[model samples]
Target: MGELVSTPLPTQFGDFLIKTFSSGNEDIPHVALVHPEVDFSKPVLVRIHSECLTGDVFGSRKCDCGDQLHLALNQCGAEKGVLIYLRQEGRGIGLTNKLKAYQLQEQGMDTIEANVALGFDADMRTFVPAVAILQSLGVDKIKLLTNNPIKLEALKEAGFLTVERVPLIGEEFDSNRNYLNTKREKMGHQI
Candidate 1:
């Protein structure tokens, strides 16, 4: 994917230079929110976040996606970092299938079991696009904000010289306890 457009975005967190990267999908381009003073010469602080419509937009309590997203944004704003928002909805299963998985979860299955029963992997996302975006922006070393071990390994395997993982913890609720447990136990998330 290549950068398609860029513009200024002012938000509660701060003013940002927003860039969209796409492979012809205008409606669902991967987005990058860059702080104005971000220093690419140093190990840039970065957060590669996947889209989560239900949780992120609707404030669904079934997971902590929205909470983590806001937390990352706050940190990025405070630290003059970069936040890469990937359009990999529902761990790459797309939105409809994700809803179906939620149905399965209501039937007493954890997140992993629900996705597995739907004939998909526990997590089907790839970090290739994130790496590409960072590279295109002249970023080599990074302090990645994440709780997923896969992200750490993915960046390391992609040849980032100094990939330091910065843990991003969020508030937990009863509504998402099981989901968090599934992530921490089955999916190897450092929740």
Candidate 2:
């Protein structure tokens, strides 16, 4: 595991601090958001969100990435939890290839098919560093908020005590319906 190198930044949200950490592995940058008044000794709410530049940054309608992010931030802020933003664009295929995959999706290909066509796995993200971040913060357990079962399994394998799975249910739209379905069916996510 890499060293926990993080620097805090200010946020408008109540007593929130954001930190960007280097992955030390040339994959994606890892980030951690610490909320005010969180008890490090107790289980915290954690959201392991993979990078979705188009939706997260530009508000693209192809998926619910941005909405999920915003919702995670709000929920975490309210409950004094943590949000670990992993920089695994397009499920760890990186940005350039992700854009190419987007073009393929526009041509009627689902997210999984687009990645497979591009010679990548359906979901290429890893969770080792997420556990590292949690450990660095002295967190031993969590109430995770996510629809991806892979995340829950990964955290369990990493030795974190995941006491509960808090479903992050959001409104579905026509644009993101197929994407969500692919995640539920192919990726085994509990959407």
Candidate 3:
């Protein structure tokens, strides 16, 4: 593990303490946005959101990333929890490949098909960094906010006890209905 840095981050959601786990090579490190006063004894609310440039920042409805990010932020802010923002762009395939996958999707392929067509898995993210962040914060149990069962299993496999799995069901739009369906049917996401 590289050096972890800490900083103050006051967002619209609330004042938070941001912790970054340096990867040594990436400019944007993995981050944990924690509410100022959290109760570690209880099942803390947690969201491990992968970096999504188009949806999270620009409000693109192509995927549910933007909505889910904001939802997690609000929940964390109000509930005094943590949000682990991973630096895994486009499910770890990087942005360029994500865009190419989008191009394939435009040609009538589903999201998973698009990724496969572009020579990538549907999801390439791992939860080791998230586990490290949680452990660094002394959080062993959490009520995870996610629709992905893989995330839940990964956390459990990483030795974190999940007290609950909070479903984050984002509204599906025409732009992402197929994508969302693909996640539900093929990828086993709860949606």
Candidate 4:
């Protein structure tokens, strides 16, 4: 686990204490956006969002990452929750591999198929870092906001008590409908 660096960030969602966690390096660090009004009396609301540069920064229509990110941020801000953003781009495949998978996707393969074709698993991302961050924050339990059961199960397996599972459902567009559908039907995402 990495050490947390305290940084203040005020965004449209609300005021947040941004903690950047690094493993003895100044490179890309994982971050946690903590809402100011987080109350320990109640279970902390949390979202673990993996990095998606194409969708998150550039607003690519190929995935629902940007929409989910905005939804997570808005909801977490409103409820005084914590959003842990992990730097696991393209579900843990690098950007170049993701683009190559995109080419395979264009040729009629689904998202998972494209990834498997490129010699990777369907989803390489994990919730271990998120769990570590929560533990570092002294959060014993949380109301997790996610559509992926993997996250919920992972939290339990990691020994964090999940008080609630808040659904994060984003709108589906033509560009990402197949991607979303593949996640739901094949990968067991709740959509």
Candidate 5:
């Protein structure tokens, strides 16, 4: 059995709360739930989102992170699932570096290239904590909502059965076109 670490986070959304669990590593914080009640065994709908402050908080048009998060919240609230907000900003590079990457993007670098230029891997995030969090909550299966195939593969490999892939489809505009395209072409995301 994996060790479980958790804490409550208050929010304005309906019954909103955050529960975090350690995935045998201090750096990675696995999670379960952002709104409503959390139930691990209920075949939840999970959204494994990487951190994005500009997009998620300010509704920045540079990426679909915020929109996707909003969609997930609505879906999870209605369907009773979990939204695991991983703190892996910029795919694990953190907010400061993500901003730097954004600047590089302004100079014509794609998201992946900008991360590489900043001395970071293209995608440094790991799914171990997510798996650990689900297991700790007794969730052995889920209906994951995402466009990233890798997330499904990782969760499955880590022993969480992805019974469904609920696509977080939405419109992308000029400001985020390149970012979305890069995610599709380079990252193999199903955007």
Candidate 6:
């Protein structure tokens, strides 16, 4: 991966340096929002978030993605952390398939069931790119902001020296209760 560009971004959460990382073929590059006061000497706070077009952009209540993202941003802003926005929409199934999966969900399938029906894994996302981004930033240790055990495991599997998990729980809503249940029950998310 190569860092294509970086610039200062002032958001309501905080002022940050946004860097774009691309693998050349991807039209949408992964991004890292770094707080101005971020320090590398100690374990830095980091959040590796996959893109959720419906939830993150349009505020869909089918899942708690948008809430989680906002919470992460706020925490990152306050703690001088980094938020890596990975372009792995729908957990790597892409937007169209994600929409299709949503249709299936409306027909009574759970998230994983819909993805499987679409002939894809429950979560096809890879943490390799996120790890690469962190490495590029010279971040050896991290206090990962997430409730997904997969994220913590991914970092350790990549041989990250010190990886601590910081819980990032999203608000539970009636619309997303089942969705969250599937994640916590079937996918082993630490909710």
Model 6 misplaced regions, further than 4 Å: none
- Tens digit per residue, CA lDDT, model 3, 1-191: 44377788999999899888875446888888999899999999999999999999999899999999999999999999999988899999999999999998888998888888888887888888888888989898899999999999999998888989999977789998888889899999997
Q: Candidates sorted by TM-score, descending order? A: 6, 1, 3, 4, 2, 5
Instruction: Please give the ranking of all candidate structures by lDDT, highest first, separated by commas.
Output: 6, 1, 3, 4, 2, 5
> What lDDT tens digits, residue by residue, belong to model 5 across residues 110-140?
9999999999999999877677666766778
How many angstroms is residue 72 displaced in model 3 relative to the true structure, after the best TM-score fit?
0.5
Error of 3 at 106 (Å): 0.5
- Tens digits of per-residue lDDT for model 2 on 7-100? 5555654556676667875554588888867887888988888888998899987788888898998888889989989888888998899989
Clashes in each model (backbone N, CA, C under 3 Å)? 0, 0, 0, 0, 0, 0
Q: Write the per-residue lDDT of candidate 1 for residues 1-191, one digit (tens) a residue.
A: 56788889998888899999983467888999999889988888899999999988999899998998899999999998999999999999999999999999899999999999999998999889999998888889899999998898899999996558899988899999999999999889998
Q: State the lDDT of candidate 4 residue by residue for 62-168, as single tens digits.
A: 89999889999998888899999898899999799999999999999999999999999988987788888889887888899998898899999999889889998
Q: Scored by CA lDDT, what does every candidate get? A: 0.90, 0.84, 0.89, 0.89, 0.79, 0.92
What are the clashing pairs of model 3? none
Where's the lowest-lDDT run of ten residues in candidate 6? 22-31
Which number leads on lDDT? 6
Q: What lDDT is reached at residue 166 by model 5? A: 89
| Candidate 3 ranges with C-alpha deviation above 4 Å | none
Evaluate model 2: give its lDDT: 0.84
lDDT of 6 by residue, 61-150 (tens): 889899999999999999999999999999999999999999999999999999999999999999999999999988888999988888
Per-residue error for 5 in candidate 5, Å, reads 7.8
**Higher-lDDT candidate among 5 and 6?**
6
Candidate 1: which stretches are off by over 4 Å?
A: none
Task: At residue 93, give the lDDT of candidate 6.
Answer: 93
